[model samples]
Target: MKVGVVTFPGSLDDGDARRAVRLAGAEPVALWHADADLRGVDAVVLPGGFSYGDYLRCGAIASFAPVMGEVVAGAQRGLPVLGICNGFQVLCESHLLPGALVRNDHQKFVCTDQRLRVESTATAWTSAFEAGAEITVPLKNGEGGFVADAETLDRLEGEGRVVFRYLGANPNGSLRDIAGIANERGNVVGLMPHPEHAVEAGYGPGTDGLGLFASVLGAGLAAVGA
Candidate 1:
């Protein structure tokens, strides 16, 4: 399977995302924000970064990028897409996913090894993880808080769309300790934590994040019979 990792102007983790895809036994295709085409990749990843310098708001501008036009269309048709950190914000801005990422309640940028509970294993990006499993991954962001209306939050909780929940501390003050969430169809996912950073053993907490990439590749290949 071919996974595309998009690199915006100030994207920081596209390389890591590509590496993670390769480590997961998939070919990593580099994509640019200005390009509308996806280069025939089976899945797409919007890596974390300070795109457009995080000017007006995180991911506000990148949501309108040319490539995201295709991403939005693909996601609606059940394409698998994972958005990390600022990319998560872009997903919300694009309305592909619900909720918004706001400033951390502490009014400071936070970076740490965060513990997350796998709430759902049905999504393409999280199927490799066992439900209710706890895993540690790197979390870094200035505006990582997740917020949504009461009805939307209740619906997400009731429908099992909340994919990951913070285990110990509510690092960013996300509602209901939500660290990540999936779309209704389970094809699209957005999260504040950086899974790509934890795919390797020596670099991060452990290989816990490898499951995310593997899950996407495995699911994509299965869907396409590749």
Candidate 2:
């Protein structure tokens, strides 16, 4: 499987995301923000970092990038897309997923190994995990808080769209401790944690995050019966 990792001007973890994809037994396709094409990749990843210097708001500027146009369309067609950290912000800004990410309650950048529970395993990126399973991954961001209106929150909960939830403690004050979420179609997902950074056992947080990448790869291969 070929997974495209998009790099916008201030993207910091694009390389890490590419490495994680390769480690998960898939090819990583490098994509640029200025490009409008998807290069025939099976899936797409929007890695973390402050895009456009987070000027207006985190991911506000990047949501309008040329590459995102293709991404939005691909996601609508059920092409798997994973957005991490600031990339998650972009996904929300693009309306690919509902809700908004805001400043951390502490008003400070936080970095740590956070415990999360798998709330839903039906998404393209999380099928490998069993519901209610606990996993730890690196979490780092300044504006990582997730927010939504009561009706939207109720719909997400009612529809089982919540993907990941904070386990031990809420790191960013996200509503209901939601760390990640998926679209209604389960093809597009956004999360604030850095799973790519935890794919390698000795290098980053740990190997706990490998399953996220593997899950998507497996789902893709299954679709092709490979």
Candidate 3:
């Protein structure tokens, strides 16, 4: 499988995302934010970083990027997309996923190895995880809080769309300890923790994050028509 990693201005983890994709047994394609095309990759990853210097708001400016046009369309067409950290903010800003990311409860940048529970594995990116399993990944951000209206929150809970939830401490005080969520179609996913950072053992807490990247390539996807 060929996975494309998009690089927006000020993107810091695009290279890490590419390496994660490659390690997951897929070809990694470099995509520019200015480009309007998706290059026909099977999937796409919007890596973490402060795009446009977080001007206006985190991911507010980047939601309007040229390549996001194709990303939006591809998402509608069932293309798998994973958004990490700042990229998660971008996904919310673009209306690809419901809710909004705001300032952390601590009102400061927090960085640590956060333990997360795999709540749902129905999405294209999380199919490799066992439900209720716990894994740790790097979480670093200043505006990583996730929130939405009560009704929406209830719906997400009822539909089992909450993908990843904080296991031990709520690092950024995200609602319900949500670390990640998936769209209604289960194709687009937004994760606050940096899974890309944990793909290599020597460089991170563990290789626990590899399953998310490899999930898309898992054989069970075709059985479910993913």
| Best candidate, lDDT | 2
- Model 2 C-alpha lDDT per residue in residues 51-131, reported as the tens digit of each score: 999999999999999999999999999899999999999999999999999999999999999999999999999999889
After the best TM-score superposition of candidate 2, give how far the Cα of residue 138 lies from its true spot, in angstroms.
0.5
The superposed Cα distance between candidate 1 and the true structure at residue 188, in angstroms, equals 0.2
Runs of candidate 1 with Cα error greater than 4 angstroms are: none
Error of 1 at 94 (Å): 0.4
Clashes of each: 0, 0, 0
On TM-score, who's better, 2 or 3? 2
Worst 10 residues of 2 by lDDT: 199-208
TM-score of each: 0.98, 0.98, 0.97
- Decoy 2 TM-score against native: 0.98
| Model 3 regions lying over 4 Å from their true place | 219-226
